[model samples]
Target: MTILITGANRGIGQALAELYQDRGETVIGTHRAPDAGHLRELDVTDPSSHAALAERLGDTSLELLVCNAGVNLDQGQALDDGYPPAMWEDCFAANVTGVFLTIQSFLPHLRRSDAPKIAIIGSQLGSQTIASGGGYIYCASKAAVLNLGRNLAVDLAPEGFAVGVYHPGWVRTDMGGDRADISMQESAQGLAARFTALNPETTGCFETWDGQAHAY
Candidate 1:
């Protein structure tokens, strides 16, 4: 199977890429930085960058595409003036628009495969039932992307494609921080299983890393 993961230079994306590669699959790890060593260049926030990456891949068949690139600009912001206009723009651009653009640009490649799957790395914070408090921008962006994944699943189901939105556990990554709930290995393993289990019957599911269905 051929898998494409965005923001694979570090964090959960890197762990997922490494896991797939070790399983002898063709893993295409993409990073925004030019000096990302073995990873390919892909700025998820830029449509031109997605186009360039797609062109570079030519007719390569992609079995799985993981939209893991995102940003949390409003992390500890106050309810006052802490969340600026630019913060919202940048957060949504990377977390929501970037995911949509990546999927749109890679549809052809995905169509080349017999069984294509899309995994969106969303957050539990995005769940309306679990809306805690802080990180408003991140929550909103994730919620938007979750909706995107659900709609894409509906639209792509007839084409033999499945889309699953996942809340990778609070992992020990740069994004999740050191005091998180689970380790990167655990999250990656659980997510891999979730992705593998995704099928047309369960296309628009919002699930957790441990394979449990999350509240939409």
Candidate 2:
């Protein structure tokens, strides 16, 4: 299977790429940085870049497309600091709009495949049931993607496609920091398994690393 992962030059995306490669799958990893050892250049926030990537892969079939590229622009900002307006813009641009654009740009490639799946990397913080606030922008962005993924599942289901939203767990990555609970390996492995299990029946499911269906 051929898989495309965004922001795969580092963090959980990097680990996921490595895992898929080791499994003998063709992994196309994208990065915005030219020298970031990416297999291709893609800035998820840029529509032009997505178009360029679509042109580059003209007719190649893509079995899986993981929308893992995201940003937590308001990471450590205090409520007193008041979430900057620009930070919210940047966060949603990468975390929400980016995911949608990537999937839209790659639809043709996915349609060419026998089995196509879209895996969105969302967050547990996005769960309305678990209102663990703090990072408001991150939570909002993730929640939006979760909604997007769920709606995509509904729209794509009749077309023999699967769309799943996943929580990679609080992993020790650049975004998650060293204090996170899980390692990249664990999260990547669990996510890979979850992705494999995703089908039309589970298309609209919001699941965690360990395969637990999470509350939205």
Candidate 3:
């Protein structure tokens, strides 16, 4: 399977790319940094970058498009910080708008394949049912992604596409911090396994990497 992953220079995205490559799948990893050793430079926030990447990819059909790029700027901020509107805008640009643009740009390539799956990397904090509080910007951005995934699933159903919005849990990555619950390898593997298990029938579901259903 040919898989296209964004934010592939580090964290879960990098791990996912490496794991898929190891499994003998064709992996096209994208990052914004031109110096990324194993990934091609791709700025999802820029339409020109997406157009260039599409041109580079040519006729390579994509079975899966993983929207794994994201950011969290409200990490250590207290509620007293007033949820920096700038940070919220940046987070939305990176986490929500980026996903939409990436999928839109890659839709033609995705349609070329017999099986097309779109996975948006979401977070548990995005779950409104479980949200008692808020990380403010980060939570709201991911929540937007979750909603996007749901609507996209419905919109793309007639075209024979499957969509999954998943939370990888608290993974030990730069963004997840050093005290996270699981290692990047473990989280990537679990997500990969879950992705492999999904079929067209389960298209619009949101779940954890470990197969637990996420509350909408």
Candidate 4:
């Protein structure tokens, strides 16, 4: 299967790419600025970059598209001086707009697959039911992308596409911090299973890394 993962330079995205490659799947891991590695350069916020990537792939059928690229700019911002206008714009650009543009640009490649799937890496904090009142920009962006995934699922179902939004848990990554609940390996394995289990029936689901249904 041809799987393309955005923001695969580090953290969960990198782990997912490595896992898929280990399974002998064709993995196209993309980063905003790649070094001397196998990862491709792709700035998800730029539509022109997406076009360039598509042109490079040349009709490659993508079985899975993982919109894992995101940012958490309002991590410890104070309510007084935190979450400024520019920060909001930057966070949304990477977290929401990037995901949407990627899906839009890759629709053709995804359509070529018999069972195309889209996995959006959302967060539990995005859920209205689980809101804890911090990281407003990041949470709102995630909520927007979650809604985007659900609507996309509805729109793409007839075309044999399954879209799922997921919360990868409090993993021990740069974003998740060292005090997080789980390791990258554990989260990656569970998420791989979730991606594998995604189908027509499970489309539009908001799920956790460990296979539990998440409240919207």
How many clashing residue pairs, candidate 4?
0
2-116 in candidate 3: lDDT tens per residue?
9999999889998999999999999889999783566888888888999998888898899999999988888778887577778888889889999999999999999999889
Q: What are the clashing pairs of model 3?
A: none
Q: Which stretches of candidate 1 lie over 4 Å from their true place?
A: 35-37
Q: How much lDDT does candidate 2 score?
A: 0.92
Each candidate's number of clashing pairs is: 0, 0, 0, 0
In terms of lDDT, the best-performing candidate is: 4
- Report each candidate's C-alpha RMSD, comma-separated, in the order given: 0.9, 1.1, 1.2, 0.9
TM-score of predicted structure 2:
0.97
lDDT of 2 by residue, 76-186 (tens): 788987799999999999999999999999999999988899999999888898887689999989889999999999999989999999999999998889999999999
Cα lDDT tens digits for candidate 1, 1-216:
999999898889999999998999999899887735558999998989999989999999999999998888887789987999999999999999999999999999999999999999999888889878888889999889999999999999999899999999999988889999999889999999999999889999999999899998
- lDDT per residue for candidate 4 within 51-139, as digits (tens), equals 99988888999999999999898988999877899999999999999999999989999999999999999999889897688889999
Q: Where's the lowest-lDDT run of ten residues in candidate 4?
A: 32-41
Shift in Å, residue 183, candidate 4: 0.8
